[model samples]
Target: MKHLILCCLLLCACVAAHAHKPSDSYLNLVVEGQSVTGQWDIALRDLDFAIGLDANGDAAITWGEVRARQSEIDAYAMARLQLQAGGKSCPAAVTEHLIDDHTDGAYVVLRFRALCADTVSELQARYALFFDIDPQHKGLLQLMYQGQSSTAIFSPDKATQQFKLTQPSRIRQFVDYGREGVWHIWIGFDHILFLLALLLPAVVVRREQTWQAVDAFKPALWSVLKIVTAFTLAHSITLTLATLGVISLPSRWVESTIAASVVVAALNNIYPLFRERRWVMAFLFGLIHGFGFASVLTDLGLPKSALVLALVGFNLGVETGQMAIVAVFLPLAFYLRRTTLYRRAILLGGSILIAILAAGWLVERVFDMKFLPF
Candidate 1:
């Protein structure tokens, strides 16, 4: 029974790992001198989203729902935005006017108002929008600005960017769409793991290459760098292509193939399958990663004109994610190379772990097993 429970536990862990998301993010779109610098924070939540069309015909949190959950959303957004806004802080002298609003659904109707002050010159704000459904449900948002209507669809249900101050006289923002609070971290588990896998191998590769020649330590690091650069270049290429919708592949295939990649790399370690042409493998695997990125853009439902902006923003998020993965793993590789014992342990342990994972995934994906789905 203990053995059976262990198997079940492992099975559940795998599912949970794969089932994870990047995080519930908090977005800050700061407009400076007619330019924008966006930063993000992530969080989690047990709430649903509320959607209502703005006066300009943009989709936003339902006004009624806003009134009901105003305190909840505001309290949630305040702490983060306050820190992010630095000395700016929340706006003063703003009037909250309740306005009646309606939506496609009966429950979508509600009354809410914008809190703005003309004399404030800047606005910092956050609000929770609940839809009584998981963010994974089908969702879309439409906004009207300068008499032009724009739409953003986020299928598989997710939060959105906020418009704190909409009036032209008070053009300011505090919280951004798609960013929540700390909750975002837990949701993005797969994103973290995928990034970890990518960075992990390069770090290991660099360390192994270093011990090959006693005097070639620096050169070994360079080789590792070359490999990392190659991988980055390859993935970045596909990330752009996939996000732009130029290259489309089935999500299942991409994910399944991703698991296969870990397998391939593990096998290569045992015997030089790719044989010094690992960059080729990285490039090929990157194509798959790019497809994974496309899945995110697909979720965003960005418009064609804003396509470039959204594309850049989403890609930036991915780049930051990749950099973080490297930051954590690279230095550890250097440390491991210092001791032969540690090196062997890493090799044996990492190889076995990767192989087991790959095997589990291959079984689940290739055969459509009920136990685990990679």
Candidate 2:
């Protein structure tokens, strides 16, 4: 146990020893007629984006023209947008982001308007800006003339130009879910943590729960299977509800509560909390994580036609990720079970790490700052 704990810390230390890699974001813009919508896939790559307004709003605007309009827009518009790189989480991604607006798909505030001034509506197009994808970004847009909120998803073909929404709007024909579903499954940090917490108990065999809990340390894979199955089934149920708009929760509260669940799960690990029916815990916590999944679809604005498909795809991505983790951990835990040291080290060290992470998250969310020094 002691050696494994040391090894884990040493591994983390070595990784942290290197400069942390920056996060990249890719935003896909779909401007249908007059309504403009943005979808992004947050990643480790620098952000690339395009303001794909399908309108000929302008004839042409030079850098000078765009720079000049900046002030006019600031003065006349009720809202102002400040361009920040990366996302809301990081403030100084300035050097990392290489922003350009002179591309074929780039939208120039004045140039586009100038080019299309003669017409009532002209589609101004700008695509392929390599930048970060931030969902809560609003300042970039000042006022939407007839912007309608809708959801979008990438076509399975992956060749379609645009996507459609769950609820058909009065004006919008197609919506853009873009790569957000895959993106969330990939970068949703909270979802990852919840899975990790639930995963911990599965890796070990409680001496109390099994007659062979400590045998060659290969107690039984059945426990892990049961837990994973329960989690998958439970979350899938709510993921649908949350996505379909049948239910909802305050984002902050849901997120905070998830962190809290991790703490509880970790505590249980040190001294079995859900001793009888782990499924109950799985079902309850899985519901919360499912809501986290729903938020991604909710943000995209589900399409009535694509709801089932979107749900299936996103859930599949999640299960794939979850199953991948199990595949990695199960073998390691199985091997370690042979040694007395393995069980102690894994439970103690794993529990501590989970608790620390969950507690840090709790402080970060509840108090807006870290309660403990890093």
TM-score top scorer: 2
**Whole-structure CA lDDT of model 2:** 0.47
38-90: candidate 1 lDDT, tens digit per residue: 33222212223222223243333355545666455444433323211322433
Candidate 1: C-alpha lDDT: 0.43
Clashes of 2: 48
* Lowest lDDT 10-residue stretch of candidate 1: 169-178
lDDT of 2 by residue, 221-250 (tens): 666677788888888898888787789787
Runs off by more than 4 Å, candidate 1: 1-17, 20-217, 368-374
RMSD of each: 12.1, 12.4
Q: Quote model 2's TM-score.
A: 0.57
